[model samples]
Structure formats: C-alpha cells, structure tokens
Target: MPSVTVRNVPDEVHRAIRVRAAQHGRSIEAEMREILESAVKPQGRVKLGSLLAEVGRKAKLTDEELGTFESVRDKTPARAASFE
Candidate 1:
C-alpha cells in the first residue's frame, strides 16, 4: 500500500476530522484513508443531452419547444473586407 503525507492541515479541520473519525468508530488514519478513497473514485460526467431528453419526455415537450439554434443566429448581412 502507498503512503501519503498531508502537510500544514488547519487545527480546526484536523479537530473536525478527528470528531468524524470517532463518530464512525475508526482511527483518524482509517477515516482519512476512507475519505481519500471516496474522493479519488472515478465520477461519471453529467450527460446534459440525455438528461434533457428524459426531462423533455417527462414534461411532454412539443416540437416547437425542442428548438434549434438557427432561429437565434446573427441575421445581419455579411460584409466584404479588402486587404491591400
């Protein structure tokens, strides 16, 4: 097993960690290990598109409400630029 050293932890934070360790019936080192493990575990990305699709299905969204960005595009005429 690999060992890690954390330096200059605040007294208040250390006290809180100790209190939490006691509550969980674990040594401070064990509690810290658990916390470190949980913190480093791989987390999945929030899929906004899938989430929106589910939400839209639940909400019974209309075709118009499921809008595209074309309507919001810049409608101004394009100008020709000259470089001499």
Candidate 2:
C-alpha cells in the first residue's frame, strides 16, 4: 500500500479530527480516509434548461413567462460583458 505523510497540521485541527472520529465511533485514520474520499469526489453539472423545465413542470409556468425567462437569460451575458 502507498503511504502519505501530511505535515504541519494545526494542533486545534488535529484535536477536532480526534473528537469527530470518537463521535462517529471510528479510528482517526478511518475518519480521515472517509473525509478525504468525500472531499475529493467529483460532482455533475445540471443543465439550466433541464432544471427550468423540471421546475416548470412541477410549478406550471405559462409559455409567456418561460419565454421572458429565456430572453432575460440570453441578454444577461451581454449585460455582464459590458461591465467587464
């Protein structure tokens, strides 16, 4: 197995990890492993169009309102770019 050595961790941070490990009934090494795994996990992006469609389906937006939202979204990039 490959080994890693993490250096210069603050004393308070180490103490907090020890407390959290005991709270979860896990060894500090096991707790650190789990934390690292979760912290480094990749996340997926949700498409705005798909998300809006889902919300519209659930909450019932009119065609005019949906069109207005798309129009506003389209112009937002241009408006944002003007500031830059």
Please tell me which predicted candidate would have the highest lDDT against the true structure.
2
Once superposed on the true structure, which residue ranges of model 2 sit more than 4 Å away at CA? 43-84
Cα-based TM-score, every candidate: 0.49, 0.48
Which whole-number lDDT from 0 to 100 does residue 50 have in model 2?
A: 78
* Candidate 1: Cα lDDT at 75: 66
Number of the top-ranking candidate, with TM-score as the measure: 1
Residue-level lDDT of model 1, residues 2-50, one tens digit each, is: 7999999999999999999999999999999999888986678566566
lDDT of each: 0.82, 0.83
Extract clashing residue pairs from model 1.
Answer: none
Q: Residue 16 of model 2: what lDDT? A: 96
What is the C-alpha lDDT profile of model 2 across 28-69, one tens digit per residue? Answer: 998899889888866675777879878986888888877787
